[model samples]
Target: MLFVIHALDKPGALGARLAHYDAHKAFLSDTSALKVEIVMSGPLVADEASTMIGSLFVVEAADLATVERFNAADPFRAAGIWERIAITGFIRRQG
Candidate 1:
């Protein structure tokens, strides 16, 4: 199944987001044990398209539990970057 993870950054969280950006990328790079495969992901930008305000990800996993595990371990989650996060099952019909 596929899941969509939409996370909005906490106000004034850019600094923390930047500080842990590398670790976040590294964590996403490897999902062997978690059994999750990232289908698409990127930062959500602000008006100017230069300031990142959040992050979005569409991933494939065996079940919601697997995706939940993957999300729970993200470095961004630990750094308190996201103020709100919504994870939902996705039904992709078109690109």
Candidate 2:
């Protein structure tokens, strides 16, 4: 199944996000290397161009639990930037 991982940053946590940005990108690259197909992923930005507020990614996994594990292992999560996170199974219906 495809799972969407939605994570919201805590207010004023952009510094941490910036600090851990490289690691987060590395994590996603590692997942891609491991064959956990990523459909799309990117940071959610605020009205201010440089202000990032969250992250969103759609990934293909065997099950929801697999996605949960991936989420738990995110560098952003480890860096304590995410104040709220949500994961849900997704089924794409059209192009």
Candidate 3:
């Protein structure tokens, strides 16, 4: 199944996000243990396109539970960078 993870950072979490960026990249580079494939992912930037406000990921997994587990292990999540997160199953009708 495919899932979309939309995570919004806290009001002032830019610093934390930057701090854990390397770890996050490393984790994304290797998700074999989690058994999930990152189909697509990127930061959600502000209107000016210079400030990151959140993160968005499209991932393929066995189930929602697995996707949730994958998300739970993210460095950003552990560092309390996200203020809110929503994970939903996706149909993927088009590109």
| Candidate 3 overall lDDT versus native | 0.96
Expressed as tens digits, the lDDT of each residue in 1-95 for candidate 3 is: 99999999999999999999999999899898999999999999999998999999999999999999999999999999999999999999899
Highest TM-score: give the candidate number. Answer: 3
**lDDT (CA) for every model shown?**
0.95, 0.88, 0.96
lDDT winner among the candidates? 3
Give the runs in model 3 whose Cα sits over 4 Å from its true position: none
TM-scores of the models, in the given order? 0.97, 0.90, 0.98
Q: What lDDT tens digits, residue by residue, belong to model 1 across residues 1-95?
A: 99999999999999999999999999988888899999999999999999999999999999999998999999999888999999999999999
Q: Kindly report which residue stretches of model 2 are placed more than 4 angstroms away from their true locations once superposed.
A: 32-35
What's the best-to-worst order under TM-score? 3, 1, 2
lDDT order, best first, reads: 3, 1, 2
**Considering lDDT, which of the candidate structures 1 and 3 is the better prediction for this target?**
3
